[model samples]
Target chain A: MSTQWIAVIGTCAFAFILKFVGHSLPEKWLAHPRIGRINALIPIVLLTALVTINSVTVKTKIVIDHRMAGLGVAIIALYFKLPFPVIVLGAAVGSAIAYHFSH
Target chain B: MSVKRDSFSLSFAVGAYGTAFGAASATAHFSILQTCLLSLLTFSGASQFAVIGVVGAGGSALSAIATASLLGTRNALYGIRMAPILKVKGFKRIVAAQLTIDESTAIATAQDNEKDQITGFWHTGFGVFIFWNIFTLLGALGAQAIGNPSAWGLDAAVPAAFIALVWPRLVDKKTRLIAVGAIALSLVLVPFTPAGLPIITTSLLAIVVGWRA
Candidate 1:
């Protein structure tokens, strides 16, 4: 088999393992106070990593650009306690505008 | 109105980027089948783009895979958090893993109640998978008809989607601080590293900050 196929299969397998392990653990074990505290923090950290990686452009320049604009809109939505769709729309509009102006 | 609005908005928003991916894959000579498979199987936009970018840049398949894998590592962390919520055992775990992605995982984790989490996971995962696959096929088949994806600013769609996803979650001082720090660090490292590496580094930094705080 070629490397690409192998990589695909490997990735798929890895994904399966993650899902099974993630969803199968007992609630009692997960809901332990210590565990709950830790889990509560996971979303924040994971979201931070996901957002930074997705939004930031760190190549030769430090410009905030369109992604940041979207993020800014998202932040504003969250601050105002907007609903999910509102947050999404705000960011989309913000990004579209940012891209239009910057480019 | 709310449900219709949600569905329309999500479809339009996600479909815009999905169309871009399809067109790009077509331009790259990927068959509609291949593009569909990638969307259905991998189901990750950034990693898919990274793989294609490396291939387009003439990098080896191994390099492309490595880059994709690095970005995909985040899913594992998502899995760790969702492990208890998903009740599947034995072979079913494998099937569940295939379904887990950014949207489903995020929706599942964000809900305050158990029933909501389950419903969110299934609805988001299944909904995204169906829509993503359908749009990918549409994009691939209509690649030529769609014209230049860049002209539509489709490249910006994924980040926009991500912003929409992340923005609602930053409800506190610590999360906001970590996000700001991660972005700053990513900007500082971009010139010195490859496209996705800065994200990994910044994520680790965020983990440290979170742990410390």
Candidate 2:
């Protein structure tokens, strides 16, 4: 199999194992406040990083482009507390317009 | 009855959003089959997105797996929350583990009574599974038919979706600060680090802040 396939399958297996381990292990293992605190921040940090990496960077270089405009529109939508789909659609529209003008 | 109704409505809404996932995965250059497999096998939104995002950005398989698994850590915590409430064993336990995700756990725990809790858990679990898979297929087919996903600015949708996912979670002052800090750290590291390393490195910030707090 190709490496992509391996990564895909490996990720799925890892996801399942993490969940299963939680079910099987003693609750006390993860019951610590410290663990909870760290866990709470993890997704926040990782996802914020994801938003940054996906939006502003292409490969190893950081370049200003339409994607930044898209992110800006998304932030506005969030500020207004719009629905999820609407926020995404607005960002896409904003970016598409910028992209059309740029090229 | 109320639990089932609530679960069904919530499930449909959540599942329909899988269309974005399907389209995003396709934009990330996943095959339709691969996209479906991600929905079927992985079945978690953020982690599945992280996989496609990393791999599509030219990260290695190891990096993809690490990022996806790290994002999935909360599901394990969800499983812990659901264990006593689920109280199953053997094959059933495995099945329960599979369904123990954010939506199901939240719905289950939200109910006032144990019966409603169990009912909410199973109904929402199965309902989301069915609808999410179906919508994922639909979205993949739609994205494929549209020719170039990027032309439609679907590339922008990926980060937009991440913003939407994380936005709600940034409920307080400290969380918002950490999120801003993470964004800054990632921006600084992007030029220097490999494709996926910047995101992974930001976890240290979380660890430090979380430990201190």
Candidate 3:
């Protein structure tokens, strides 16, 4: 009804359509070797991008900050082959300490 | 200890960010109803954030939709990745489509076997959906109280979870090289591009690697 509502509905619909279309693609198309190979790599690159963006940036500006400390701890935890929850906790605690001291 | 634990851990890591989103949407002047609708229907965290970020900055509704939709592109890509693996039809297809998201797809594909893959997909999808919605409500209601999510280092949780997800996949040198290149590509494009584009652009590196390989 309102502009905000309209935007919300429109965006939601568009997102759903995008998702549905991908799912609805022909099995033959998806079965192509190139498509399959490319799909396998999608998560790796995207997740890498996600990690970089979340750690280094505050909004649009790139700044080295406490999040990087969290990332460092996460890497070490991963290297040690810690459990998922522990690694997550280590990163959060690492960042929180750095954040408190910096601010 | 496999898909179940992985799904649960990944779900919580991803869902916890909903607090940040809830606080942000409320700060952007979205009514609780509007905020909840975005989480319920839109369901995608980054895209939802894009909507609030644009609108909160006094941008037009059209701009907000455009930006949010751009981020939602990744879900479509994930849907493509999951379709054959899921093999759902008719009504089930829609359900699967709705549940198709980053955490679900990531955990699903990360598993070794078909059973674990399916289990991971459904568990992570539903787990994240439940936790994300609940956290969104709490964040919206207590927007003022939450202050900065990053202060709790919740910001670190996302990337940490991402690292954990992708870490296992980088077993071979080729995949590892591609990951490194993507990280470099994304960082380079961050300042020059809009929020979501840099991430999307990294897919090019994957395509190139996949093509060459």
Report the number of the highest-TM-score candidate.
Answer: 2
Better of 2 and 3 by TM-score: 2
TM-score of 2: 0.97
In candidate 1 chain B, what residue range of length 10 has the lowest lDDT sum?
B149-158
Indicate whether candidate 2 or candidate 3 has the larger DockQ: 2
Docking class of 1: acceptable
Q: What CAPRI grade goes to candidate 2?
A: medium
Index of the highest-lDDT prediction: 2
Please give the DockQ score of every candidate, comma-separated: 0.25, 0.77, 0.46
lDDT (CA) for every model shown? 0.58, 0.88, 0.78
Candidate 2: the clashing residue pairs are: none
lDDT of 3 by residue, A1-103 (tens): 6656866887889888878988977656656777667767876777677677767765566879898999999999999999766887789789989999999
lDDT per residue (tens digit) for residues A1-103 in model 1: 6544544555444444544555554445544454444344444443444455545543333445675777777777767877544654566567767777877
Top model number, DockQ: 2
lDDT of 1 by residue, B1-213 (tens): 233334444545554566656655665455676677778777776566555543433334565565556556556556666666876666666656666777777667777788778767666666767777787788788765655443443334444444545565577886677667766775666577655455446546544554554
Global lDDT of model 2: 0.88
User: How do the residues A1-103 of candidate 2 rate in per-residue lDDT, one tens digit apiece?
Assistant: 7657877899889999998988887777677998899999999998888888888888889878988878899999999999888888888888888888888
**lDDT tens digits, residues B1-213, model 2?**
889999999999999989989988888888899899988888899998888888777677788889899889899988887888888999999988888788999999999999999999999988898999999999888888887665688888989998999999999999999999999998898888888888888999989998988
Q: Which residue ranges in model 3 land beyond 4 Å of their true spot?
A: A1-11, A59-61, A81-85, B1-39, B44-93, B100-128, B135-144, B194-196
Candidates ranked by DockQ: 2, 3, 1
Q: Candidate 1 at residue A98, lDDT?
A: 72
